[model samples]
Target: MKKLKLIAVLVLFPLGLNLVGVWELQRSTDDHAEYAAYQADLAEFRPELQAIADNSGSRPVMVDVGDGEKMEVKMALSRVTEMQDELDTLLPLTNVMAWVAKGTITLGLLAALVGGLGLLALNWAGRRAMHSRDQLLHSFTRVTKLLPYVLVGHVVVMGAAIAAIVAFEALGAWHAGRLSAGEMKFMFFGMVLVAGCLYSIWQMGTQLRVMLNMFQPTPMDVMGEAVTVEQAPVLWAYVKDLALTLGALPPDHIVLGMAAGFYVTSGDIALAPANTTLTGRTLHVPLAYLGILDEAETTAVIGHELGHFAGADTEFSMRFVPIYHGIERSLVVIGQTLVDSEWLQRATLHPAFMLGAYFMESFDHAVMHWSRVRELEADAAGAQLAGNLAAASALVRISAIDPMLQERLVAHITQATRPTSEHVPVSDLPTTVLREIAALPLTLPEEEMATQLPHPSDTHPSNGERVASLKVSIDDAVRSGTRPLDATQACAAMDRYFAQPDVLRARLTDDYLSHHVQQDAVLVETLRTHAGNVTGDVALHEGARLRGQILIGFSGLLAVAGLILLLAPVLFPGAAGRDPQPFFVGAGIALFIMLCMLPFGVRLFRRAHKTALLLTPDHFVFANLKAPLPIRDIADFNLQVGNVVMLTILLEDNAPLPELTSRSFFAPDVALNKKKRWLMLPMSKFCRDDKKLKLPELAELIGNYVNAGAARHLLQQRSEQSGELKAG
Candidate 1:
């Protein structure tokens, strides 16, 4: 059915293009004939007038005008010649139009033929696959292998055709002597086409370089800078043995880096010097994963990555990489080039270009679809090497652990910054955080997990789909008596392998801090001071209050305008003019606007009015709260910073509190159950200027009362640091 539909499209699309060409040619031809007749009439009329003027008795000729009126007029031969000259110049354009029309028809038909052949080939491949299960698999695999080449071919052909059409049009315009400098400059669109071709060539060149680079031996010094593998000989040996057991060439280099996943890159040993074998590769294991997964799970990850090498899937996949990138680059370049240039923008909006753009996008979607399939096939191969259960478990574990690790790392940073008597050694941080994360109940719910299906643009299958595939692979592996390696020992080996754990921890911590922290020391000091304050309700920032008032005032004006409009006609009859209908319509629209604005205006008024925080010596009262939150019951204070500063108040118990009618526009504070209590307060509501009272300060201030010991310790540390600076 799909094949038939494709065939129909191939047959009709080009024919439709040809029809447009035919219509344009006919119209231009008719217009040319009309202009030629008008020129002929003027030529004959001029001669007659000249003849009449030549005769002395016919000094003034009385010509019969249209509607049977006779008009006396003196004929000028020069004026007649001028009119004929204008038509003579326009006649060449008609010829050019006719030539363009013919070119279009020819190109359209040629495109149709090529499209038909391609569709027929696809149909043949599909039918051949359907003959048997083995043939079907072969056919599917072959299509995946050839699809990129086919798509690239299509792009080249289409791009050439478009360039030709544009070139022809430009030539026709130039021949007609109607091409302007500005029009000639639109030839930049052709340059854009050339640029796309160059980009594709560049992409292929880069791919070749990458492919060659993959085989070359990685320098020990470069590897040493980013990853540490010298300490974990056992883990390294195990991974090597696993590769050998899986019937794959072992990677020469195995390094632990900071990325959160594992992967293998293959190089051809044949390209290397005489001492090296033709199969050289590198395996990169993320330090983050090492701390999170157990030994068996880690082995499973290694197996999965090695599985790609075992099947040569990694090399095969690289073949399509250039093709994919080329298509993407071409689309971006062409679209942007056309859209950016004024003349080209109008020119490229032609049907041919529009159709070509659509085809390019469709081709991209198809390639991505195949890319996802390749990922699933790789997953299956990994399962075969690692055992289905182990592979699937590792896949699930990684997805769940990664996000939790990030959250815990941030918390760890927050905790470590406090001036504690017992300092947390930097070397122990990664291990400590990982252990804590492992203890948390962080599994994603089944329903939520199911929704992680692959998007159209995704290159890999969803976690859920991958797990399912692994489950099926697991049954086959079990029957084959595949014995999975012990995960515990692998994890222990990784832990032992890092020569300078402190360096790794410091790097990761510094990276996290750089991205997440954004406040100066003065702001922190201000927050500390505020944290110690046991004042009455803190008012909303003056700026925030004023902004809220502005919104309220605007909404109020809208409401007043609507009310006046609604009452206008009734208060003064015919004041809206004789058309009562238009008046009523206007009033109705006004009333609707009022209805929408009034509620929003009231909300803004309340937000501005109730902008103060009420705090007693023992408790803190949020905006318009009837009761205060006891300081002793507060667990901790932290900040989630973005455009707005959100102060998260962690409480020890889930005590019900009165709901504030006014909600923060930024993001409402979440109230979870008691014991795991956390409430968010947008600091923009209280402090307008970040320079005066930043998010970090608010966190510190709240932290002091919530956890006074930590706050006091931080303050002491700050004081000592300041004193040292002063002394220096």
Candidate 2:
């Protein structure tokens, strides 16, 4: 709803510009009594000059005696002629200004009308298209293709408006007969707007290139080892039969990984760990879950994945995936790069780009709606392949069991990697997991069973929703466990399919654990180094101070520029000509802007002075802390890098903690949790010679003090894994 309101504002921005143009037109074209008198005198004096020129002898030429006073004909004629010359010069400039204003109003009206109506129609079409699969696919494809054109149109409209503004200023200076400081400043401003528009376009092009690159095939090594038909003949045979039964094409390739759930993809798969690529229709089956889910449950899960390949879903994906990634990249670029640009802000191009961005963003709700519908459709297909109850049971179990499995795996990895504990091989992880799954309660809690499954490829329906859609009770699904794992192999799927199930499990588990341990080692080292008392000037806060100073300088420049514009007409009377209203108005606006910005700049500057962060074994201190905050109460910390580099510190507030405040004008305090307080630390460059607190060092220090540094290790593992999509 907030996004909709923002889009409306953007769409109406051009109309607002039109209103300004209208006001300017009226102001420029207003009747001046002095100029009118000059015109009247010129009319009366022209014939008198002609008569005087025609006379053979010296004659006392009587001028217009409207006030009953006769003047010297030659002298009156000279004054009237001078006024006529001035009028000839000023009238053309005034006409040009009027024409420019009209043009601006016309263009602004068209842009506002077309942008608003077009987005509304598109939004309506998008909502209507959700009823049919083909329509849904077409709607998304059409919008994706139209996005580039919409952005281009935005640029063109903004460019034209800027051109109009520049033309008006240039012509105004030309009529003035000399360049004034005000004219030069406005011209410079117009140039900056053009530069910002061009830069923003270049950035969009760069992001588009990134989107195109995503289409190329990337490796699946990080996801898992590929399984050929020869290696898993039974599994291959089962999948082919399942695909045929579900009226879908079988996967071109199969990958076995230790991820939580199953998923299918037709796009290029990139492997994060190995930085490699794979191309083809791929089906990824979770190795850990294979031992946990029985035959019927496995059949239902596999059916659900294959259901995506049914009804031309994968075929649509071939077109949709690249566009989806492109939109994501574009939004990221707009938010992170273009949105923060000072040039764009000054030129007001930021609002234009945001308009385009939000138009694209508005489609997300529709996309999510249709995405959920697609999932539900696939769920129905899965139900058709297996019994509805069986499919429901599989969905419920997958959602419930995965978190439990992750907890066990993370716990084991955390303990095994500890400095005090002996190295423990994870070769028997499959057998251990199988035992744990068998030991799970016959019925899971409603909260756990009602949650959505963990799938990386798309948003999923909740377990209860899927079960209800399948016309089955949640309790029935929970109680309907799959048959036990084979006694010897400890996994039904492994027993039925692989010739060497134990060996494969051992290799995969060892590889997964080794990768995690290697990543954790670096974080563990950092934690150990920063586990003692430390004091240093926060680079984040220092960066904020520098930004504040820059802002102050910018505001000062604006104020100075405004003063110059306000005084330009007086200092250079000839350069201002007959009117000085434009200069005064421009000066007023600039001064107002300066006034508004100065306070924020000063606040940021003052608050960031001597800002230091102190970390100790027990607590940490930041800004003007009334008391040091307990390190043990530190819940988590996240470092965000972009236009503003910031570190967020979350502290548990259940117990009495220090009254902490940032007093930052830009990034204020945000409430993240009911019983927790959030502290924002703005950061930038750090001293690398172990002198100042680094962002990563700060996170590590907090992680070390919290939960015996186990979360620190877990955080590293999770960060890498979540950074890119895995098999799940």
Candidate 3:
């Protein structure tokens, strides 16, 4: 009982107290101490009057003490008093309000109360918060798994925001006929704080409203009986059952509400549409969330939300709310300060301010990307909760409905366009999965199988990436040892995970690579890890080459320019004439050029990766974007036959391959570009007599080098690794 009280107080009360503390901080900027001391000095002392002199000390007068010594002591006291008087005069300098003079005692009491409350509350909530944060850190392990990629993403976004700010400042500076970089970043960050604060408030309001609605699972009464099935149990009932099934000890509340799609509490999933109160929550998916999702996608609705529930995020959200609020408040204060800072009015004229703006924008992008990851995590949790059979069933059910009339009056739409839904049975899901437990299994434990989560400072991968992970986990499980998952169920799970568009977008990414490149090329796909399959060999040599190029190019460029800026002046002072400005300008230009080339450089690097493999007469030269790993160094590979053949590139060397593409999107450029383009004219002519162009060894090498490998040696290696009777 004591422990429980401590946990609750720690988790909940501190949050409330912090809200007050943060508000208090917002209200006062002046120095309270200086003002209090000032008031204390002024309370009784008169500036014009002198203290009465005491001549008699037990009749041993000033003469006995030595007249000069007595006078010096009195003068010293007078001087000390004058300094105090001066300090008191400057008391208002430290504070806007004369708090000490105007009821200082009362203010002190109030301050003490607030501070005491905040400290006490924090003591109570600290442990729970730490526990929840640790778990959150666990959830982000996926981010850590792709730490390089995530770090790159953060760099990209933050860099962009800084760039934008710099650009704006440059424009302003150009207009002003002057520029200063030093003061711009802070100035821009100030504006960002203001904007961030506004956004924070808006987001918090949305979050709060959403949470409130969480308690109300069913639709609003305004819709009356038409809102749900007649006499159907309220969504809360489902939440209760689902929580029970999940083995949630003490049973946390389960709620669902989003504009369009389903979502679990904390926006992480724990159930699959198990139960929810719609009253406070938004229902009737908005077009943004819906994005043409047919109305009948009940299982999809549940699966995505439940995935979030499975994240074990209840405690996370409870702790997160306060931190989020604090950050939001900070942003608001910062934004307001930036807007109000007269000093920044001049500072904003600097090109650096524009750069600062760019940095802020990048932060926004990071936040957005993290948000997308949250969505993906939710989707995975939802699928696990719903089960492969059920999730697929829900998708199939949605797919079968008529193309038209999805949002029409409920049953009317259901009656008008229900397709013959085709899907694997629910029983097909691996029985070992255990849909919802009261608590995760003690021996195996839920955390063991959990893909390592990310650290605190990671931008999330997309939903598709997360779902693919779930599939991969199940697949690996099947490969290592039978965990009882049927092929049909696995296939269905694969299909269902792919169905989310949030998972399928192939777009112009940071590398400037098109979606097709992202989808087809294992290298580019690895870089842009939003969605799609990794159906290629895990060729470390190729991945290493790509990563190396990207890292060296980006990291080295900045390092070099920064070093030159600080060194050129020292090395060539005679040429520089001791003017550091020129050197700094040169360094800045170099940095600018490198930053500008980031996307293009990244693309070329990835391009080089797929182009690295070569079937040499001696041995296959496994050169890739990162570097070449010759067949002599190759330890193994895996090959699979499907619509497109797949390979798993691996290395005999200690170095591991990038875990980006686990399969190959191997095909001719033209064939891949179009669905049905072929290589020859009409085939009616007699082939034996007709002369046809043939691929020479060089030509084959060119074609193979243009993309990932499907050459003879590579396949043989794969065969050998599989222990499938080594080909003669």
**Of the candidates shown, which would achieve the greatest lDDT relative to the real structure?**
2
> Per-residue CA lDDT of candidate 2, range 424-532, in tens?
4557676666666567653467687557777665767676777788898766777774334343444655556877777777777776777777877887666555543
lDDT of 3 by residue, 499-579 (tens): 232222211011112222333355334423421212333221122334437655775767697677868888878777857
Clashes of 3: 93
By lDDT, the candidates rank as 2, 1, 3
Whose TM-score is higher: candidate 1's or candidate 2's?
2
Give the alpha carbon lDDT tens digit for every residue of 205-238 in model 1: 4333322222122322112122324655666677
Give the CA lDDT, 0 to 100, for residue 587 in model 3: 85
| Selected candidate, larger lDDT, 2 vs 3 | 2
Prediction 2 global C-alpha lDDT: 0.65
Please rank every candidate by TM-score, starting with the best. 2, 1, 3
Give the lowest summed-lDDT range of ten residues in model 3: 678-687
Q: How does each model score on TM-score?
A: 0.44, 0.66, 0.23
Report the CA-based lDDT of candidate 1 relative to the real structure. 0.54
